[model samples]
Target: MARRNEALLRWFRQTGWTQRELARAVTRLGQARGYNVAPDSSRVRRWLEGERPRQPVPELLAALFSERLGRPVGPEDLGLGSGAPPGGELGWDQRGLVTALQDFTRSDLMIKRRDVLGTTAALATGAVLENRLRGWLDPVRADAAPAASAGRIGTAEIAEIEAATRTFWTWDAKVGGGLYREAVVGQLKAMTDLLEHAYPEQIGRRLFRSTADLARLAGWMSHDVGLQGTAQRYFTFALHCAKRAGDQRLGVEVLSRMARQMVHVGKPREALSLVALARRGAGARIAEAEQAMLGTCEAWAWAALGDAGRVDRAVGTAQERFSRAVAGDAPSWLGYFDQAGLSGMAGLSYRTLAEGDPGLAGRAEPHIDAALRLRNRDAYARSNLFDLISLLGVRIVQGEHAEAERMVRRVLPVTGRISSTRTVDRIRPLARRARADAARSTDAARLAESLDGLLAV
Candidate 1:
């Protein structure tokens, strides 16, 4: 506690913030925004003394400090640290498949809630996700090795679940999340239960890998259904399962996806944190193919965080690593990361950073075009949505409404196919702009109405 308090003090002082100044800033921001807040001096004393602010108030505190200070600040900013001990949050980092599955029961409950998480809640999650990635090279060793499996889960069962998951993934990706999120979540819960009781350790690891994939899909499904808290929980649960499988490569992939979620919800700093962890995890002892996959993901995160230099470095690393990821050279576990996937990731990263760097937008398009040419439906769906977003932004800047509208019409229905929340969220702003643009022109009335209808739904 003393060490934590000292760290908090150092952070505050280094940021040029006094306890009184921070409190004053928080109160002023709150009052201006119509929130009732206590005066700065009292709040400062309480915060400095280690009292955690509760409720809607916590959001206000984070918002006020972050806005004024020009960096992301969470509850930890005020000297209130996690309720869980250091690396205690990383208990999810436990390596035994069974133990990780057991821990999901707690995480599942947290995911199902609808309330806004206070900074502490989010920070706790961020900590777990980040730690898993950062410590990938030196995963916590398990006390008991998993018992060897008798055999694979019957071929029939594996086939059944795989087919269903793939089908739902396709359906959700194309139709809207409103299509089959509940069904997928239900399937995941049931599968998790069955996998827990029936499978031995080695087979259980593979089962848990599938389980984590499904869990992440469930999280994406939740995001589609607008249950962010629930989605976050699933993502966290998926991370645990990935760790349990000793699949750090896939674990980093899941974290990258989680970072994408953060970016969608307008939390770019947290997204940066997740990506940093992914890069840290991929630094050593991972397969070359896995290294490329993680590097590409980190590139995306840096792009989202508006760090051009890091984004370029990561993209370069991703391309080089990806070149080393030949079919003969890489593990079966890494086959999903083909040339098209890497290119899609590169395009997506550039598209994200394009807003802050127009020149990069031009550079991003060729990759986006190449990715689209490959037409891996799901990967293409992601690339198209992001490309549309980037193009729409550029069009808006250049006052090219007709072109932007054309892109929107082509992309919206395409976006409708994937089970990606971030993709959907990205298109919303573009749809809004299109409608507003359409409203201004005599010929655009019908187009504006069409866009408004899409946006309304």
Candidate 2:
């Protein structure tokens, strides 16, 4: 049998197309390009299962994704190209960065278009991003020079954008990304437009840093609402902005978020690679809290791999670093990862750890409870909901039928109020484990049904 064509499948799902829809869209695209080809659901299925289309079809597919992804998407990206192309999709220069940002905010890029650009995101591989960092670590003088356009902007405007980013972040944590993604994108578009003008050296760096912060927020919110590919694209460009700002810490933080995305997609080894690169790039004297955050990320990756020893060491390192954290030692960007954040991350690691070994359920509960207790009722309510589900997952694993039932009964009703894809993702596995065990009680069966209803999976 042919290989399963995971590359094509990954992009296909990222496109959020039903087999029939993809078939119809590609067929129409081919016709528009003057190729009289007929493709249906079966044809799409074959492509997904490792069958390459005849000449011109793969090219059409590439064209479709290139337009949809806002970046170059070749046949290689979809597993239909020849000659064993390197496993990455990263080739954008400084000039190309503006084009990428502009493509993201196109008015024509609506959800119901030929492909959902913002609503569904394609995954970016770790190799692709780390490759970009090669340029970031060392910058050229020409790239750093002030814009040649008629000079105008200053520090005041940069301050406003930075404040707006912080505000949006707070909103994202309180409300889900689905509610305000368009607003974030719109602001991001306006911010990108400002780059056309000129500012002095200090103001220019500040502007780029502010833009980087906003772009990362846009990416985070995109990921929040299930737009994985869009998130990656935003993050890739945010890295571009961070580099332009000459801000090493921000770049490391962006990589950390990318690592989180990897973990979410079950690519923990990739996640580990990203975190490792981030630490190595930061060098020896990273701030205490940032060090803790990075360590927690490492522990989470270790937990995903079921490496208990490594997980313990990483978490221990994180906690130790967190204790020594001094006021103002971290940058303003570090505000989000406070005591509550560290506790929640530690809990999440153990919860992921419990996935591979249910006996570790006890290890996860206390930290999650601490997170639940410490998280601000208004600012981090959405996260609190996620932690509640973490609690439920741990309970289910520990064989607490009645308690789990009570918890889900309460949570099931409230979850609909939240609108993050991460929440949906959290429910997915808990729903699976609840239904899989025949030994589970009626309460467990009902809980699974509720979760399935929420997910419709």
lDDT of 1 at 44: 61
Which of the numbered candidates is closest to the native, going by highest TM-score?
2
> Lowest lDDT 10-mer window, candidate 2?
83-92
Model-by-model lDDT, in order? 0.61, 0.76
Give the per-residue lDDT digits (tens) of candidate 2, residues 1-457.
7666777787777677799988888889888889898899998898888777886887777667666554445564566654322332433344445544554554313333234433433464656556655565565345432246854667776777778888888888887887887788788888777776667768777877888888898888878876777677778778878877878799889988988887887888988888887777678757999999999989988998999999889989999999999999898888878888888888999998998899998999889989988888578878788888888889888877668777877776667777787888888888788888635478778767767787762
CA deviation > 4 Å runs, candidate 1: 1-90, 93-167, 170-178, 195-199, 282-285, 328-336, 377-386, 412-421, 431-451
Candidate 2 yields a Cα-based lDDT of 0.76
Every model: Cα RMSD to truth:
10.5, 7.4
